[model samples]
Target: MSCASEQTSKNPMYTISKVTQSQLTDKDIFDEELDKEITDYDIQEAAYYAQKGFRVPLKSSIILAQSGAQVPDAYMQAALSNYYNVSVYNGFSKNKSSSNRRKDKEQQVNNNYMKLLRLIAAKGGQNTIIVYWGTIEKGDLDDKTNIVKWSQYEGGKLSSKTKALRYLLKFTLVDVTTGNWSSYSPVNIEIDYVPPKIGSSITDALQIDELMKKSYDNAALLLSEKYKDKTK
Candidate 1:
């Protein structure tokens, strides 16, 4: 997927929408034409709010399904949707399984998110980007453990009364890029949130983190189950 680095820093980003399918066509994606069109929609919407002068972030959703699907359309219609765009590098692949496409999309999307998290973490952490890199590079790259845990942090406390803490979502940066993985640009960002109290009654913030963690895993599992080696 393409990132608008030059255009993005003009404003900050926050708020994320869930990934969904859209009903775009191959003719729509030729030469990234469709993404550009929608990205323009995102820019205009951002500008509209920029004129009003708000610190709101440019938020967009990733494509979890095919082109021209409802998720993208719904996000496009969101009051905040205008500030964001959808992406799925493999969404238009006519030769791949929908599940595999979704997994690839999840990996790629999370990698991008991790970059943002890394920047945020670096603001107050002892670890530097170089240290983070060395850790990941030392392992069997194919294994998930080889991935870099940018660092761990306390997302928040469980409660004012209970001394117990909630989920500790590890901010992981894994490689999901297309070519030689020298940069963090094309990777998927995974927030492996593991909550503390997983049962009922409590906030279960850890559960929330677990759910986030499962999003990527589920995408991969679904892809493997549905497509096998059929990915194009």
Candidate 2:
């Protein structure tokens, strides 16, 4: 009689080598460093693509109030063109009363005057438009108590108490395609003016024309700074 015995395979058993704690930690650090490098390379590539060709050449139209109480045509056109770097056109006209009436009716219904302006700009082949208006009112001094004061002028001439006048200039820029718009009003300008004495024929007390031009220039400069990306 023979006893039965278990037999082992002739091939050696597969064994995994022991990994120390230090070895495992080093491998994790190497993997983290590799991931960081890949992430940095992706960011650099994205930035390079964005800076290649983003802005396109555009043309703009400028529309002033119909009352002809805005900035001079020549100055407004030149200032905006230089600051915004776009071809500027005058979209104001005195003979568009019929069209104006129709637009007014539509504005009453839709309450979107900006959309009307965009339509006008689109007709003129303008990608953008600038519309501006201004108002003048009496202003008080810093103390807010007195609106008039005796101030000395050039040559130390003392005149009667002069009143202060505040000028507010409001302007808006609209994108014809998107109908997106921005409005701005630069800080108002206050000037002391000696009103013409009763029965005096002198009418130019505050030089309203010059003040209007100054306000328009300030508005253009502000717009240029705020929308610098639109430049060319």
Top candidate (TM-score):
2
Give the Cα lDDT of each candidate: 0.26, 0.43
RMSD each, Å? 20.5, 33.7
lDDT of 2 by residue, 27-104 (tens): 211112332346787667656654552322333334432112222234445556555434432223222113235645
Candidate 2 wrongly placed segments (more than 4 Å): 1-75, 84-113, 140-162, 195-206, 230-232
Q: TM-scores of all models?
A: 0.19, 0.46
Q: Give the Å error, residue 168, model 2.
A: 0.3
Q: How many backbone clashes does candidate 2 have?
A: 0
1-232: candidate 1 lDDT, tens digit per residue:
3222212111101111111222233222222323234668766765665454211123323222223222222221221123323232222223221233554574222222233323433443312111011001111123445443233222334232222212111111111221101112113323322334545553444343333334334333332233222322
The runs of at least 3 residues in candidate 1 whose Cα sits more than 4 Å from the true structure, single-residue gaps closed, are 3-205, 230-232
Question: Model 2, residue 196: displacement in angstroms?
Answer: 4.9
